[model samples]
Target: MLHQQVFKLALLSNALLLSIGILQNPSLVQATPSYKASNSGVPTQSARLNDTLIIPGLRFGPITRTTTYQDLVKMFGASRLSDHDVFGAEGLSRLPGTKVNLGETRSFLVAWTNNSRTEVAEVRTTGSAWKTQQGIGVGTTLTELQRILGEFEIPGFGWDYGDVVRPKQGRKFKYNIPILYLSIDLKAAKRYPSDYRAVQGETTILSSDAHLKHLGIKVGEVRVYFDQPGMTSAE
Candidate 1:
């Protein structure tokens, strides 16, 4: 009985020491319900937040105008984000931006208001996954855009701001919300030189232009600009 008691005490002591070690070193502790690791090894909570809805003129996932670089790093693992200089419209200037997922299909660019990267000036994405609540996104056809936007205007092609959508009057989205700048480009503008020529350079081409259907135009990129003071127009 004495020997059995000693063995039991030794086992209990070893278990206690192991528990204490785990408490002292958090890395050794098993994942709790609230702190589980995702398949990619990032914390599940952060990974989940990264998939938040993309609301135009509002938020991209959990990211907003107030979101910072560190906030992005927290939502998306640091390994997935890299800093780079994004060229302003027409290659006029270079602005600091964060490239998320880089070359991946879901990749997007977040341009900062300043070098500090504490304020997001805008978010641009060509990924179809990042769609507005109205289901507008990259790959949305001209007809589809017309259906959603209900008579918008696009800048003429073959220029810096070519193909960018603009509100005909004041911000006339069919939904009556702030504009989400979409760059819709013809799949093969060069194929139909006449059609291309008709829409090139500083001209405002109405979305209802009957000729646009033959050009195979689609939303190539989507940009959400935060309403920041001194914020210039979308390029």
Candidate 2:
């Protein structure tokens, strides 16, 4: 009878341990990051690599005529920027310029090239696959993702931002994970030759990438995909 009691106690202890583990591992008991992102949080790091991938870009408007962040403020008066990075560089394309700096001004210029045309893309990330995955809870929402991640990296696109990312949810899927879609709109730019708009656009993308790569050891490559309106005035 004593032996039987010990065996039963052992079983109870094992059961208790299992319960504790499940409770500790929120993902196992609750939802996965992917699931949470789909439901309400940002996309998980895994979704970017293992699932359909797309980098986020900014939904830009004509700011070319405006030369400085101050100029932007004059027109916008604290208007909302589409949470994304507007940047560019030279080494990759051999453009006769240096590195692009987004932080130079809250509002900066972005250039891209289309068949000898130069233009810029306001890059944004919907949600990057984390350098590693994180636990997710059941009631995760976009607001929650913003709280935890604060910022995200886009895939194959040379842009990212802290504020622009918004979370969305849709129909459920196999893993019961919702699909999270984020926008990566290249800012809309209009041409004005007579006005002579001269804002200092970012010089190089390399520096920004370096910063992110350092920020997250396992983060992936950074590249910008933009529309080229036409080449800048040749030097």
Candidate 3:
């Protein structure tokens, strides 16, 4: 019985010592910095290209020309602009699209015209990063574009913008309608692989593989513009 009493006293003494130690140094009971768990609850990265189609008479992804600068930052996350960065500048392109800076030397210019206080007029790009809902974008071969858009007219200047396509046939108000205008880099298309050269245009009749190689045959850009009679210009 004496030995059992001594064993009980030792167990109680250990519990009391532990409680006193915790009371004197409360931090010891607290979670350690390294042992503490956390969750950011947000994505650290995003897609490389916006991939949002520049739909005419509609919306460009989730934004438009009138999307305020603050909303733009909120939607696309705050831009990591540089000291020399030129945002919404005109020198970027011949059109009036405002450049929205996406960090790391990438951007898309949102332009407007017709003094239409509504949707964005045009979305232009010189890069091959972005794409449309139809999977058309820069680096798409003329043959691929033909397969996608179907029955488009070639521009007078050869592989360039100003190539217009009607949404429908025979309309008196067609002149005032909005048409799809493709902006292409003729020089880049001309340099595409031999297979891409097989695509034929209205003026260029491909008789042989060699002739096809010499034809300008790739889509380097795409634009949706409103036919504003004497207002639209090619770059």
Candidate with maximal TM-score: 1
Q: What TM-score would every model get versus the actual structure?
A: 0.69, 0.20, 0.44
Query: Candidate 2: which stretches are off by over 4 Å?
Result: 1-55, 61-90, 95-105, 114-235
Q: Rank the candidates by lDDT, best first.
A: 1, 3, 2
Name the lDDT value of residue 210 in candidate 3. 44
lDDT of 1 by residue, 100-210 (tens): 884544788899989999998878777777665567777788888778667877667666655666556443333312223444244566676677677767666898886
Residue 5 error, candidate 3, Å: 99
Error of 3 at 85 (Å): 14
The TM-score measured for candidate 3 stands at 0.44
Candidate 2, 89-144: lDDT as tens digits: 32233322112222322222333332222333322222232111232222234344
Q: RMSD of each candidate?
A: 22.4, 24.2, 28.9
Worst 10 residues of 1 by lDDT: 226-235
